[model samples]
Target: MITEQAPGKLYIAGEYGVLEPDCPAILVAVNQFIRVSITKTNSAAGIIHSRQYSQDSIHWVRRGFKMVIDNRDNPFEYILAAISYTERFCLEQHVKMKLYDLHINSDLDSSDGKKYGLGSSAAVTVATVKAILRFYNVPFSNELVYKLSAISHYSVQGNGSAGDIAASVYGGWIAYQTFDKNWLKQELNHKTLSEVVSEAWPGLKIQLLTPPVGLNLMIGWSQQPASTSRLVDETNANKAALNGEYQQFIDFSRQCVLEMINGFENKDIHLIQKQIRVNRQLLRHFARINQIAIEIPRLSKLINIAESCGGAAKTSGAGNGDCGIVIADAQTDVTALEQEWRQNGIMPLDLHVHQSKIKQ
Candidate 1:
């Protein structure tokens, strides 16, 4: 049996800017993870099961030149995609593989199984790809696994920045630069999955980051799941409705990111504080332009409490819901703030910064 797991992630900064195809975003892997376990099976067919998915096992078999999956709408779509891509990559390289049963599980959600928007799909994709590669004894770099996982994720999700995928693969603080989607889309028009995996991704870039010394970090969940894609769609629609408006927003977002990165690296506390607040305002501007309620009531309350405690809080992901990160000084009364959050039905996750990436 072979088992692998990858951690979920949160973006510290640079959420929307990374979508520009070549911008860098800072993010971190959290302690919660999605775990995938694989064991050899005597039967010709293999089964895929997930605790978070349906109870029944999904049956699959490899034909002479293709992998045939029985269920197309299985909850483990990303996992299945990972399997297919890895299998295809092996076939392209002429590597032999064996049949196995794969079981998937995760800790990125609550006891009742509600997601906290910790990028579960990305974690699942990374874990599945890693497990599949090892099942066939394929030599892999974490970078390769990341590229493979991003390919799989993009195939299903379409036009994602893959920051979540990067975080899952690397398992640490990262100032990640998104790959060129235009180039990728063009390449996909002519290249096979195997060729894409093996070819040198000329313009792809990634870098690990370190937070400033003595930085205090906190995360709060609104318990409201936001549809990241829907918010993205709304923002995109607004951007398209007005010419040059998107560029203006992009300019602000880019500056916000620059200040954030430089501020953290230079250990400039005031700069960091200013940028955090500036970014939050820009995010609010984005929501207003798109006419979407990104800052839900709970999140607004969270921001108020954190600000009252001498910190800054904002929507962390695609906005509208999910988690909000609170940046505060060490002396901030986090205990009291947490009590207030609980009173308001918000959950504070005690997730520490992850300094490691994927592990054996």
Candidate 2:
């Protein structure tokens, strides 16, 4: 039997700007996760099972009906996608494999009426690619797995930088640069880019706060589904209008990132909190990527609530109906905030900044 797991993630900085197709973004791996465990049956058929989800069946076969998400579509489709892609690649490259039973699972509980956002999705991809490689006894670098996972995600989720994928896989505070589409090559080696911009200081501490009661952490649905296709279209349409704004926002992010780094290095809680608030505002201005307002009033209210408690808050993903991130003092009473959110039907999470391992 083969089992695998990966951590969910949050895009702490850089969302819309990475769409330039040239620039890179930064993300962090939160504590949430998606795990997979599987054992191949010698019955000439590959089965897929997700205990987290009460659905299981023959997902792939050697000669019978082909396994596909549309047929076995569960939360594990992304994982299978990576597996399928890797399998095909391995076949083409003649990578050998042994048959084994497979079981897939995830610690992320989005179906529990809790919203951890897309971090689980990224985690699935990371874990899937890793599992597949291990099952085949293939020797691949972490960078290679990250790239493969990114490619698999792009195949299904349209356009997304491997930045979040990188953070989830590498587990650290990384400065991501542009990635090459060729999974064999592109890696998030932001240290090189940082050296290019080395004048921006070095030590930066990014603190993520998860309220105990889940108050102040809300996911607005926009009450309307915004498909990736439509969002990408609008993004392309706004290109001309966004060029200068993008540059300005990037500059703002860079500067604020510097301040954050300095504050973290100096251990200045007041300065870090203030700069986080400022960065949150700047990111919000750049992230309004939709036509309908995603309950800005509610979001604003939450921000105000957090601010009143001596913390900072902002939208975590591509806004217009996504998760919000809060930065609070280490000693802030998160339970009180969580209680408030629970009353409002919102559940908060304890986001973690995972340690990064750079084996150069």
Candidate 3:
């Protein structure tokens, strides 16, 4: 059996702005992960299993170079897409395929099956692609894995800046600028998967960051799950009507994120925390102009408490609800803060940053 895992991610800054090409966002890979394991099977058909789904198992068969599944409303859509794209790349590299039972397990969700807003879908896609490639004994790099996984994810979801995918593949603190989706979509129409993966994608950049010496990150779950895609789509629909406000928000967000990146490089925790506050305010203005609630009531309370404790806090991701992140000095004791959060109906997560095992 071959196994692989990918870490979940949280957006630290540059929320709405990152959707635009060349706009930068800061994110961190958390310890939570999605694991995918592949085992060779003697049966003619392969099985895919996950406890998250209601079905016992989904059976699939290879029919003339395509995988056919029995279920139409399949919950393993991302996994299946990853398999299909990885097989295409394998074909290009002259790798033989075989029947295998693929199993998936996730730590990015709650015990009761609620997402912690940790980017589980992106992690699962990266894990599935990595597992299949490892199973085939194929020589690959992290960039190759990211490209294949991104293609698979984009093919299915059809939106977002893909910062989560980058964080999952790279597995650390990262500064990411989204690639031009229009260019990628056009390239996909005429280029092979291998060829496209080798090309320099326009506006795409991923830089691993070094955390400051005394930086401490904390996560608080609001217990309310959110749909990132739905919020993004709603924001996009309202962008045109906002006139110059949308562009202003993008410009401010870019500046805030850039300064935050500088803080990381200079090991200035104060500057980083200040920018976190700036980013939060920018998102507030963004919400006002777009007429969307990026920070709900619970998230507002969460941030207020963190700030009262001398930490910088902000709503993570699209953030109608889900989790809020806090950055504090390592010397500070957060026991009281955690206790206060619990009292306010928030669950403080004991998640740490996940460093990448893959060498750049």
- Winning model by lDDT: 3
Better of 1 and 2 by TM-score: 1
* TM-score, every prediction: 0.90, 0.72, 0.93
Off by over 4 Å in 1: 55-75, 200-203, 357-360
**What is the per-residue lDDT of model 1 for residues 1-360, given as tens digits with 9 covering 90 to 100?**
889898999987777767875566778899888889999899989998877766535556687889886442233778878888888888877887778999988888777767789998888889999898888888888878988999888887665689989888887777777887777778878998767776767556777667777677789999887656656656666666855866777778777877777877788766777777887887787777777897888889998999888887777888778899887877678889999999999999989876654433
Model 3: worst 10 consecutive residues (lDDT sum)? 68-77
Q: Ten residues in a row with the worst lDDT in model 1?
A: 68-77
C-alpha local distance difference test of each model: 0.80, 0.56, 0.90
Winner by lDDT between candidate 3 and candidate 2: 3
Give the count of colliding residue pairs in each prediction. Answer: 4, 20, 0
Once model 2 is optimally superposed onto the true structure by TM-score, how far is the C-alpha of residue 27 displaced, in angstroms?
A: 2.6
CA lDDT, candidate 2, residue 205 = 22
TM-score winner between candidates 2 and 3: 3
lDDT of 3 by residue, 1-360 (tens): 888999999999999899997679999999998999999999989999998754425556687999976331243888999999999999999998899999999898898887899998799899999999999998888889989998988887778988999999998899999999999999989999899999999999999999999899999999998878767878889888886988888888999999999999999999999999999999998888877888999999999999888899999999999999999996545887898899999999989999988744
Candidate 3: C-alpha lDDT: 0.90
TM-score of 3: 0.93
